[model samples]
Target: MTTVESKTTSAEATKLTVPSRPGFRIGRLSLVRRPFKVLVNLVLLAALLMLVCINIGRGDFPLSIGHVIDVLLGGGTRIERFIVMDLRLPRSPTGVLVGMALGMSGAVTQSISRNSLASPDILGITAGASAAAVALIVLGGGSAFAGVLATLGLPLAALIGGIATAAIIYALAWKRGVQGFRLILVGIAVNAMLTASIGWLLISADINDVSRAQLWLNGSLNGADWGSVWPVMSAVLIVGGLTVVSSFTLGALRLGDDNARSLGVRLQLRQAALLLAAVALAAIATAAAGPVGFVALAAPQIALRLVRTPGPPIIASAILGGLLVVGSDLIARTILPVELPVGIVTSALGGPFLLYLLVRSNRKASA
Candidate 1:
């Protein structure tokens, strides 16, 4: 297998090295600030902010960006306040958080696997969450949002399901240690079985339950509010911080398991932690938004390309992911008479991108 050398192509990252402090070797923020990186981040952020503004007015009655900001600042008429703060505010954050979570998780997944196509969606983590949520909604006679999942919410169920499924896949793939290729293969099998289960549940479900179940499966943010934003924001802050801190390890891991271990990296514990972290990120996004597709598959790769880095650029991926989701949601809301689920928009974009990656990867391998 050809390995991606842990060499950074960005001259700026190469030059701005901070000396290690005494006592214990502490990691820095590991932020990349190349001119291209800066430009890309700025453009993406601007685009994200633009989309957020646009989506705030995405209902039957649209408001200007000025009006949306006015409502956000606590001075608006009844309808304006209701539209921006109550109805649209949570949706923006939900889409952003979902994208960030999936993007960072996808970066970690691909970095560890050394496979460009390795993402939570392809590796069955999201499928696992989906299946569990569907089971709760359909079989256990429990609601996905209320009932058993009320306290921690469906996100908890999703987290458990995603982590458990990941564990099962890893266990099945373990032969002394987890190999990336083997892990991907096992994940594919698990994803297939779990997808079949979801299909079965959907098919046999009561008519009344079908619409509710499908809505979640489609990953819509129809009624997103502050209730959804807090939990997701908390996850993004805590888990996202950890991802940034640990990104150096992911870069090292991309140099190949043997090489990373040779450098005295704690391979087993680190791998487990990274996997769990990725699962948590994916699970949170899945639970909050119901398995919106493709952000995970595309964000890290897009970040790497933009940032000119050998490994997944965590912060860049997060920003890109947020932009992708928010922008997609904007399109989904305004592209037609009726709003489509953001997931459908992402799938429409990501599907072709994934196919292109596979074809390119195959061509390179053949070459």
Candidate 2:
């Protein structure tokens, strides 16, 4: 062969041998595919499904998984349908959706702040919602007129309070620009204040009102019905969708502000947008199922480790979050003679995890 022809053939061979990048593109958006992450998500999803079936089947009238499936598929007796469909079904979905929202929100906040400790519960977003909802519950009392107002206004009040708290935290954190550590510090302070406010409200409220608000503050799905599930589902579909779509910015932000800016990321605008979405997700979840603690804090980190991703993978985090909550709810309902709130189970599990993270961070810093 001629020298030029030999060189061209070798170059073509090299091109053929080199592998392409592992993701597909859709219009302007490029999504990177990770097989391990996909497998993790699928496994998490299957676990969540299994937990849901177990949760549905185990109660005073214990049905088998097959029986639950039969009831779900519209083949069960009326009593079985009523038992599974009417009562037990709502709680699992509500917990799953709430977990998914919290998980995604946690992932966004942690990624943006570049801090493992940054989550809605720690950062006061959930606290703000809790305070607002408690205030409404206390003020409304048991009077017919006030009760109606509180019933109608509780979710709205929580939403507004969460947004307002996030705005305050952002403003306080913004010294020239919002730093991750500063944001976390500000969030912690705000959360403390909100926690105090909720306590004061509970102390000053009527006994009946306090009773109601206290149950909510503990984050129970005791009263969850189909009514509670739809709002959370809607929020997840809308705000959650927006959060997922905009998450590409998180990669650039993780590389530091100068790098992000170099990549044409409007840093302030993007941060604010992401923070807003995260806050909204947490607030809506709180409204639906009170402040289910630590799901947000734990899910993303667990998912990050599981997926072996530099940043938390949103979908994996979400699925694992669902699994965590559903499984916790199952434990809460079945393990004890008296059912406990799902939040109690999560808190019991997450408290140690949080401490472990803190200890790990401390060790790394000392090193």
Candidate 3:
């Protein structure tokens, strides 16, 4: 038998051949291993591009899409360049940036909380920022520094408020390792109290102040120049970078405290870092876009569903959030002869989806 085996040819050797183990792939496609998800992202990107193109040419004095493209390529009339560069491009980027911040923050918060319902608004972050901005606007009327004060103080105040709220909630919920339900309950309570505070501030303010507050609350991108764009862009860049860096820790955290700890992940420190970054992002976005609610709530969940993965899906959420804001703003501007508030359009569009989520979730739980 040994002699016969030794005499075997290369072709006959296959008769007793061991199965070859599959080799590891080394490429981007191999890395993700999820082509449909990539296709979905591509579709979203395409839709967003189309929407931007359509909105660029829409106004009382509408420019052609071709002219808009020409302007983007660095050749167009003075008005065309001004409108594209000065007006539409800035607004578009602002919407996109704010949406990105909101979406990423929302994803982080919901993951950290381990509660699908946890959102920037639900955690009192947006409410805090809005309250601070409204107070500044109401109390500092008629001064040259009024806008400056509101703009500058808004993010800072929001930052403080968000940190305080998170601290309080975390402290309160720290019985046996910050359970998701407990955190969400505390967050909801804090959000309600802060929202009521905002209402009272509005109720006591003068009509003009209230009107200004209302517009801010409605989250307009009407005058989003580069100056206005930078703060938000900076916040998105800094906080976003921080989040991406900590994303692996976040994935670990999703496995629960004990498992994460066993894996050599420092639980409290990583959680604090992620939470702080998330809060900062939410605060900055809120300061920029008022309480642009529901986008934050809806975008991440939608993205997770689309991506068919777990743990925040931050990049996809950001993209979708930006698209949602820009598309909603476009609808707000064009659907009515008079422009609607961007916030109002987002709420209107997002509210229905939110209701669907709630009902579906409820049904699932009950079932």
Q: Against the true structure, whose lDDT is highest?
A: 2
Instruction: Measure candidate 3: CA RMSD.
Output: 5.6
lDDT string for model 1 (146-184, tens) is: 355445557788888899999999889899888888889
Candidate number achieving the greatest TM-score relative to the actual structure = 2
Candidate 3 total steric clashes? 0
Task: Compute each candidate's TM-score over C-alphas.
Answer: 0.87, 0.92, 0.85
Segments in model 3 whose C-alpha atoms lie over 4 Å from true places: 1-35, 141-152
Which residue pairs show collisions in model 3?
Answer: none
CA RMSD of all predictions: 7.1, 3.4, 5.6
What alpha-carbon RMSD in Å does predicted model 2 have with respect to the real structure? 3.4
Give a tens-digit lDDT track for model 2, residues 1-367: 6999999999999999876657689998777777776787888888888889988998889999999999999989999999998989999999999999999999999999999999999999999888878878887755564465476677777888899999999999989998989999999999999999889888988899899989898889889999889988988899888877776798888888999999999999999999998988898899988989999999999999998988887888888888888888888888867788888999999999999999999999999
Q: Give lDDT tens digits, candidate 3, residues 135-226.
A: 67676654554445555576676666677677777888788678877887887887888888878878988899798888888888876777
Which is the better candidate, 1 or 3, if ranked by TM-score? 1
Window of ten residues with lowest summed lDDT in model 2: 140-149
lDDT of 3: 0.80
Model 1 ranges off by over 4 Å: 1-35, 140-152
